[model samples]
Target: MRFYIQQFIRTIMMAVFAVFFLRLHVTGELARYVNPKYDGMSQLAAVIFVFLTFIQFSRIWKSKKDNQAHCSKECSHHHGDDHSFLKKVISYVILIFPLLTGFSLPPQTLNSSLAENKGTLLSEGQSLDIVQESDDHQYFPAVENTDKNHNEKPLPNNNYLQEEAYQKKMKTLEDVHSIDMNEDIFSSYYEVIRASPRDFVGKNITLQGFIYREEGLHSNQLVISRFLITHCIADASVIGLLTEFEQASSYEKDTWMEIEGTLDVTTHNGAELPIIKAKRGRVIKEPSNPYIYPVLRKMTD
Candidate 1:
């Protein structure tokens, strides 16, 4: 009887990877890690790992005749059998550590701390290229808001919108006197308003997000922010509107809220941007999916 111990360990590692990825999808935790649009890719990875695990399993058991033939001096082939003991231990530990962490620790939502770390409040036009593309760009002719949330085709909540559909969403938004920043178009629409704050002056608006505050914000002002995840949580960046209300200071950072207000011009570090002059607000529980992903595709890419 003969057994390839290294092959057995490799098989187990491959199986672990397959199961770990499957667990994330089965438990609905995958969305917390990546955009739903790429779920097919991750599921594919899991399938490949499963296939590799089976292939490695076949290598773990061989008859004495096969083992002897395989290990003969004339047939010498490196398959990790010559790895130094210390090298093997260190390499396995390095890999197993992250897998252990993934299983033992729950995934976390991106918080305002990440926003503060990036040194971007998303209020400035210059830093937005990191998380959002130009939505309205400088100046697009506006369309009348005949009906809010009405479109020739309803915008899919997926990661990309067709060019025509995207333009329609932005065009309708610009001409509207009031807006509700829904999750479907949050990131794209936000960049447009940030790009052309003057066009949206005095327009009533409603939005919801966790509270974010920084040093220079007035006592009446605090940011209502959401982390915008482009590819995955690792690439998340904070985006939101500056909001001012009489009782803004009563809410602590990271408190979830929904607020109604009107858009008005504000200067941040000498650049003009939109700020919500909050008329009324109510505290709300945090959303299950708190991240805002970019909605439109960059057809240019």
Candidate 2:
């Protein structure tokens, strides 16, 4: 038993990893950690962990003769018993900490308070059209999203779109009289609006996001913001619109709301930016999945 104790502990470690990853998938929480487009790879990791557990378990009961079946006993490579007890304990503790926390703590839903650490949705001179998707945004051609002209779809896992669907949404943007800014098309259309704020002026638009405020906003104004994430939440960027209304002061920060009004242009630092003249709005519950993903238009339309 002493000879195999380290082998037993290693086998248990591998098994725990397999269980942790598989549980995230079973409970549909894997999206909380990474972009859904990469789910296939994550699931593969869980599967590989399971395979390793079986393979490592086989090593625990092997006799010295069978252990040498793969490599000669003369092999110089390190094995389970190679390290001192204290060294082994320290190394394994480091490996175990993240896994234990992953199971013991829930993935926090990124909200307004925590989002400030990421920075303001837009800088004083930042133009929405200049906000390009970073390298991580490149995935499955075009992402599936919602627009005013189309029905909303299930989010998080199914956010990436087939090429056909993406083109249709792009075309819809050009032809629609009103814009519905759902998670799927929010970032894309924001670029269009800022690129030519005049073109969208008087256009009635609707959107939903948590309330956020920053410097340069009036007391009657706030930013309706969402975190734009790719791969992981830690790297999320804030994206939203500057909106103003008399009732804005009545609502506190971090309040989630759905609002509709006309799109109007405002000047800051002599640059034209889009601002929502909110007509009517109501507080709403926080979304189940609040993060907005950046999309890639794989094919030219």
Q: Which structure among the candidates has the greatest TM-score?
A: 1
Give the Å shift of residue 71 in candidate 2: 13
TM-score for candidate 2, please give it: 0.80
lDDT of 1 by residue, 1-301 (tens): 6788888888999999999999998887887898878889999999999999999998898888855665767765675458799999899898788789999999987778877898868444332111122223212122232333332333434667777777888888977888989887898889889998888877988897999987667776789998888788888888889887667777789887777877778776667878887776777666666777888555553
- For candidate 1, the TM-score is 0.83
Clashing pairs in 1: none
lDDT, candidate 2, residue 279?
71
Model 1 RMSD to the real structure?
8.7
Single out the weakest 10-residue window by summed lDDT for candidate 1: 128-137
